[model samples]
Target: MMLIVTGYMYVEPSSITEFVEDLQKLAITARQRDGNLSYDAAMDDPHAGRLLIAERWRDQAALTAHLHSSDTVAFVGRWGDAMRGEILKYDARRERGLMDE
Candidate 1:
């Protein structure tokens, strides 16, 4: 099954820039990981410190590999200081979808 990972980060109103930069690096790294379908990030409410991350992986194993990758380590390390909340990981299922190739 394809996995969709969404995360919400509530920052301390400060460190927004640093957090975003770190997330950008992380998104790129996630996309580079094997079996990763997509990885993207966005800032919520314009100037708001809320950050949202979306990811798609081939399967749980692939997602696990991504979590254990060096990029993840660096991502966490780089943003460790500015992190202010918990990261929630959820398992998802697709009921309807189509793609043209």
Candidate 2:
């Protein structure tokens, strides 16, 4: 089974640049983790201080391991009221490309 995570987070506008730098680091590390299919983070709206998050994992075990990974903790720990987010996860059932024939 595959797992997908998606959400948005708001960071202090002043921290956007640093946040992006840190996020890029996290993304690079996460992509190398076991069972990680894909991971990405990007600014959804800089003016609104909103950033989008998307992740795909091979399975629940993979996602769970990642949740407890040191990189994850460090990234999260950096958020001391400097960030607020709403995230959701799902177990993919059927999915298809919008452009698939």
Candidate 3:
């Protein structure tokens, strides 16, 4: 089953700009990974310093691998406490486009 992961994190307001920039780069790289179906990192509330992320993976193993990938680890480590946040995962059994018939 596909896996969907979503979450939000609070970062130092001053760092929000750079964080989002770097996150977008990471998302682009992740999408090219073996099992990454999609990846997104965006600012949900700039004033509140809330950053949002939504990722889709082929399975648990793929997700785990991505989590441990060097690039991912480096990105998260760079932000450290400033971006620490909660993430939740779910099994995505199926999906469809809004206009799909």
Question: What local distance difference test score does each model get?
Answer: 0.75, 0.89, 0.87
Q: Which tens-of-lDDT digit does each residue in 1-34 have in candidate 2?
A: 8999999989988889999999899889899999
Write model 3 residue lDDT over 15-81, tens digit each, in one string: 8899888888888889998999889877789998897888999999999998899999999889886
Scored against the true structure, residue 86 in model 2 reaches a CA lDDT of: 91
lDDT of 2 at 99: 93
Please provide, for model 1 over 4-90, each residue's C-alpha lDDT reduced to its tens digit, 9 standing for 90 to 100: 878777766667777777777777778888889888877874466887777788889999898788878777777767665545666
Tell me the TM-score of each prediction against the true structure: 0.77, 0.90, 0.88
**For every model in order, what is the number of clashing pairs?**
0, 0, 0
Q: What's the distance in Å from true for residue 84, model 2?
A: 1.0
Please give the lDDT score at residue 40 for candidate 1.
Answer: 81
Off by over 4 Å in 1: 46-48, 85-87, 92-95, 98-101
Reference-based TM-score, model 2:
0.90
Question: Candidate 3 local accuracy as lDDT?
Answer: 0.87
TM accuracy, model 3? 0.88
How good is model 1 by TM-score?
Answer: 0.77
